[model samples]
Target chain A: MSLFHPTGPRVGSLLSGSIRQAAMTVARRDHGTPSESDGAPASTVVEARTSGPSAAPSLGPSFRSSEVIRVEHLAVSYRRSDGAEVRAVEDVSFSVREGEFVTLIGPSGCGKTSLLRVMGGLLRPAAGQVYVNDVLVKGPMPDAIAYVFQDFALFPWRTARANVEIALQLKRVPRGERRRRALDALDMVGLAEVADRFPRELSGGMQQRLAVARALVSNCGILLLDEPFGALDEQTRLVLGVQLSQLLESAGRTIVFVTHSLQEAVFLSDRILVLSHQPCRIKKTVEVPLPRPRGPDQVKSPAGQRIEAELFQLLYRESLV
Target chain B: MRIRPASLAEAYVEVGPVRRAPWWSPAGGRARLRGALRGRRLRVFLLRWATVLALIGVYEAITRLFFAGSLFLPPASEIFTRGMGVFVEEGVPEALQTTAVEYGIAFAVATLIGLSCGAALGAIPGARGVGRDLLQVLMALPQIAIYPIIILFFGIGPGAKIVFGVTHGVFPIMLSTMSGVGEVEETLPRAIRAMGGGWVAVTWRAVLPSALPSVLTGLRVGAKTCLLGVLLAELLSSVNGTGALVMMYSANGRIPQLYALTLGICVGAFAVNTLMTVVERRLTRWRG
Candidate 1:
């Protein structure tokens, strides 16, 4: 079993009073988006109340809409220093519909990152075709999509707001509009106060959120995040995961994420693509039916546990091979 | 359970509404000003200058009370005055001007050549690896040893000094450019490219800007090395400039004049280093 289990003994004691209270609030409180369909005990959480927040219930069944991104028999390889081609990923096929968060999870060095990069048009597939918005992607499509790098690859020299403005600058957006929109995105991510602060001045989670703000400022339809919170600790990841679900709640953009954490895969993903060892291939696809707002409590619920277990086993077995 | 301590705060500090104190309010304005003025940076600045002045006082005392003649160890006050004397001294002013001109011309040439070469070397991998090895070898060789060959080829005019300065200064700037290019994390350029930003946009916007601080750093080192190189050439071959003046004074046992001339060169180098630092800090103000 992994550490930081919500129901486990250590989680409550390990977390300080405030975080425990926040976690308690998150696990117990429901924004009451969908009706009371949960099979879990009501005593565990306060009675669900119908609350109308700014973000109306996810706009349409964009999940049921046409495939926004698709890959068929996609293969990626790299030439060794000795000049021999070593395959990283092959024969992986998947489709993500509009406004759905699809996560790719696998064993270490399983080419999950390479597969994501290929879809982003960063790395060319050695064989087969990858499509974004039904167009075969040959290079980066920054206008249509934005990639959130694993390391929170923010420019060291730009302020949090300026970093968000980079893509808009490339788009040649008006200066007034760019500054206003950049601040709006930072405000959306709860980083409005740090809009003028440099990246180094902020904490790790703030930097990660700033990166997300940078991606969001352009308002691209598709966001391809390669473990945007990979460098962060488990607590930060949990909070960012919840924040991402809320972001999706409001924005309703198509997301393709690559991560190593099974809990993370199950927590935020509409569907999880589990890949095998090198020469990576999709072994299974698990669809999460836990509804729109999947919080820390939802992740610990029966539905979330079953899917997390399955994902863990798939990755664990692949790693053994 | 080997759980580490909570190295991270799980939540951010609660933020409150911003309230700006009225600028015209005497008590509020004075409080903020005092808080800012008595800050850590100001204290450090004062301490730094205090230490410098104290060291100067100790040196002054030692030279006046313990030292022998003016040729052996001139007083600090005399050195300062004599160092400034090169300005009004008849032929000394011309020689100083010549040295200043030579240094400026050499530095400019070095920067132009170094930047172009570094960008070219960094942009291509086949060249970067080979050039890196070549640079390592060149950096290992003593610059003094190359003086004979350079003077032979270009002669004892501005040509030899310029070439020498370029040779000394170019490597650091080039290496800095190469590393700066390296520092532009691949993700940024890729992100720009993916965002409809073309190659030219990527190079100009992301590549050059990100590498600037590092390139400036290389320039700082290059400037000092160029100064050293030109002066070295002036000393060995040229019959004019500060380097030649120092040699002429030393040969005639004009120790105070030699010391003054050397001090002038030091001050000039310090100015270059300080100016470059200010530029570097301005360009990289966002960095920690």
Candidate 2:
């Protein structure tokens, strides 16, 4: 049996009840009666702490493990101009183990971006659940999740460091700490030298790295990268892919990466999840058996070649469909 | 084909003899200077000036020779002489000062009103269509046609001039401001939101900066319109300013003075346009 029932009324009741109870407590606090003045409410506070909001839905002991994210039965769809609903992702399910690098490889328009958006809580799934540390995500949980977009969406007006600082700012981190963390993140991406330069001044690869730095600086447990290096040339992509692997390994963050390139998937992932075309479903999940601290030569190794070939065939078949 | 030494020499002489000078030598310096003069941007600038000068030359020649001593079509030289006197005249400074004040006030008021209305309308969802249509209708109604109505209300003073100027100036500014805010890139807003910005944050950071270049364009157009409005008011009813001076000279049959005042107004308009253009360029340099 599932530890946290997927469609449990208990979880729903817990969410609503906690919100109501929080509101009531806020009202009582506003009215200025100290908890000690009301002994009954003081006992209620102890109950609220032990059996209240945090206890409502059992996020499962799996969440307590190093693993930071768990997703189940996620579906995303958009209504077309003609009023037809185009389901982008349907019944997609996956989980990221703590400090593991996993990538979703699929053809273009196969809902890779939609999947990442769902992971980041930017889009609410039609009929599924995404749990970050046992809590169901309803909106952007910026404190726990950061996203690196495919297009290297850095603010043109801000310097590379400022772009990273912006994410920290949203989290309400103190100024001195924000800058120091931002600088450290930039240093990890090897963009510390160009910290003062604006996005326009950087090359495509550099800009992508700066975006990675921005995501890293947020100190989120889970990072969702939607084809972060898709726009770069091959040589730059390969170099940056290795750099990213090193950075994430050092940070010990769970990453759910999406990419169109099979080689990139094989190069960076602990496991490669192959997704089908529109209304994308998980076709297969192939565990990448390649050794860690993977380099370019490993990608050329016999095992890497076999994995790439398998992913290619799966992607090619999906495309034909 | 082989050529005899004499024939080669003759050909060289005919074609302009090739100088045995280094690339940066005096001979090469002439060629470089010529090339610089013929560069595309320099050529275009020179062509504009040349056309304006040619038109003035044609007007000066026609008025001097064909007008047959008629004061109405005074020659350019006569206008220049009278223009110098008009500049030195006792009340001319005060008239210029009054026109400057009126133009400045009109431009400032029009810009503020235009930007506020334009931004509010442009940024609102589904309202741009109605706003644009209304603006188009307003723009179609000429400010000149309402001069009598405005004079009735403000009674032919600086107030009327300012009101007239503002009426003329506001539309272009509004339209430009709307266009500027409308053209903010689609990805910019999405990017900001993805980074966890709320509506106000997106507007202040992404939308405003992206719309700045367009705003500058509107301000330039508004500046020109303000100049036009001020002139129209002065010509129609004002007691002072370059426009009133022109009207006084015309009524008095002082054709030379009238032409000089007209020239002065044109120069003033040109100067204001040039200043605004410079400001626009400086402000929008980052857009490229």
Candidate 3:
């Protein structure tokens, strides 16, 4: 990679210090190649290439560039209640490939949630730009993206199916079709039987599932999840981690997951972007070359464990910052 | 004899190593407890009425024995001696008729104005802070002390009485609405906005339903106060309403009919309060 020669120098890139130098230091990750990081001890990329063609859903001309989302040196800051300026996200740059399940992992209060909010156009970045589906995102585009919140955020007045229906309702889908699609999404999440149940009536795990179903009910190509399983127990988390991976896989959707759990990131993600503390920055990106149908054993394998440990070390050091 | 078997859920219980508390007793035991409760319910009902009857009896006996001839305190028997007679002979109905009509109009209009103003203040943060200070100040001020001026401006008629009633009744509704709108969760608005909802949708779908229970409570408070305010204004001027006749009867020391008329107005006010309370409870049934 050339040290200086490049396309028009983006002002946001200067704030991150460098673009060309940073690109060269990182491996070839612009495309969904996710090149497998060979067994080089302490190599920054603790990952392997994704199973390319199997993950590809469309053969259309639009599939030429696999990048579905690009965060161009984003910086987000806001004023605190004490009237002090707090920088939430600082010069965080990364790209998510189409049909990829990428996880943003960091310690608590590290701005992973802020970054996720920025991606969904819920919060504006102070500097830089976020491009989703090749268009600059200025505000919430329900048709382009769907968000699943940690608290479930399900409408208590609405039934499980009606909650899901709202995703389509917002898109202006006809009532009949919205209902049909809602039921189908519920079935995909194994919640079809409880379609009429109110969100308050459901258990913690079920409520989260209903939220997931709501996200799916929308035809949005990208799903943004912020700690969707953070409130669940160990047993439910493990089960959901596997089930969610399969659900997203079959649906051929791109998902950006925000989480604090290193193990969860390793288990579900095609690539894991470890974020640093407070004013969050991308610390490392790990690729899991582990084969499909990842069982508990696969997640607990030596390779997975090594990548998880590396992420933990980066997180621990960044937590102090 | 047993009426039925324990439910399927109840049948699965394993015996505890130690005897459990009666509070943790089986569903079968609950049925027996419920049956016993039914018997006690009737007795409780009788006992409640008995308590009221005993109080009235005691009051009548005490007044009859001590100071029976005093013009101030009247015996219960004497109070009801002209119970039906007061309605026809003393013009009690006309007084109550005027008060009821004025109270109804004042309460209804006050509620409409109060809810709208309160909702506006609550939905907007800047308005809420200012409204909170101003509303509390107005509600705290003794409106009774200012009734004379209200009558001087509007005159001693139903018009003045209604204006007083409305002024008194409007605050609770406004206060309740402010708090109710505040209680609506922030998440609902974001969700609606994300789904392409406009301001109208957010106000109607999220703000209104969320604030409903408290608004109903405010309305109930408004209704009770409206009646009191109208009566108070009437009492100040012996021109119209039950307030006017009550003043007239008391000045003449007609204690029995005065007591009876007072009792009727009190009962009517209580009935209105009960009705509003029932409506509020029904509207808030969705609350867990």
Per-prediction backbone clash count:
3, 0, 2
TM-score, predicted candidate 1 vs. hidden true structure: 0.81
Candidate number that wins on lDDT, 2 or 3: 3
Scored against the true structure, residue B63 in model 3 reaches a CA lDDT of 94
Docking class of 2: incorrect
Q: Give chain A TM for each model in order.
A: 0.80, 0.79, 0.80
Model 3, B1-288: lDDT tens digits are 010111222122111123324544686578656755788876887899999899999999999999678888888888777554687774667778888888899998899889988988898888888888999999999899999899889999888999999999999989999989977998777777766667787787777878898899888888888887898898997487889998988888777788888898989998999998888776665453
Instruction: Write model 1 residue lDDT over A143-224, tens digit each, in one string.
Output: 6788898888787778889888987999999999888878767766767766777787777878888888888777677899
Per-candidate interface DockQ score: 0.30, 0.07, 0.12
Q: Give the TM-score comparing model 2 with the true structure, all chains together.
A: 0.76
Q: All candidates' TM-scores?
A: 0.81, 0.76, 0.80
Candidate with the greatest DockQ versus the true structure: 1
**Model number with the top lDDT:** 1
Candidate 3 wrongly placed segments (more than 4 Å): A1-64, A171-180, B1-50, B64-70, B77-81, B88-90
Candidate 1: where are CA atoms >4 Å away? A1-65, B1-72, B77-86
Please, what is the whole-model Cα lDDT of each candidate in the order they appear? 0.75, 0.74, 0.75
Clashing pairs in 2: none
Residue lDDT tens for model 3, A119-168: 88888899999999789988888877889987878887777899898777
| DockQ ranking from best candidate downward | 1, 3, 2
lDDT: worst 10-residue window of model 3 chain B: B1-10
Better of 1 and 2 by DockQ: 1
Q: What class would a CAPRI assessor give candidate 1's docking?
A: acceptable
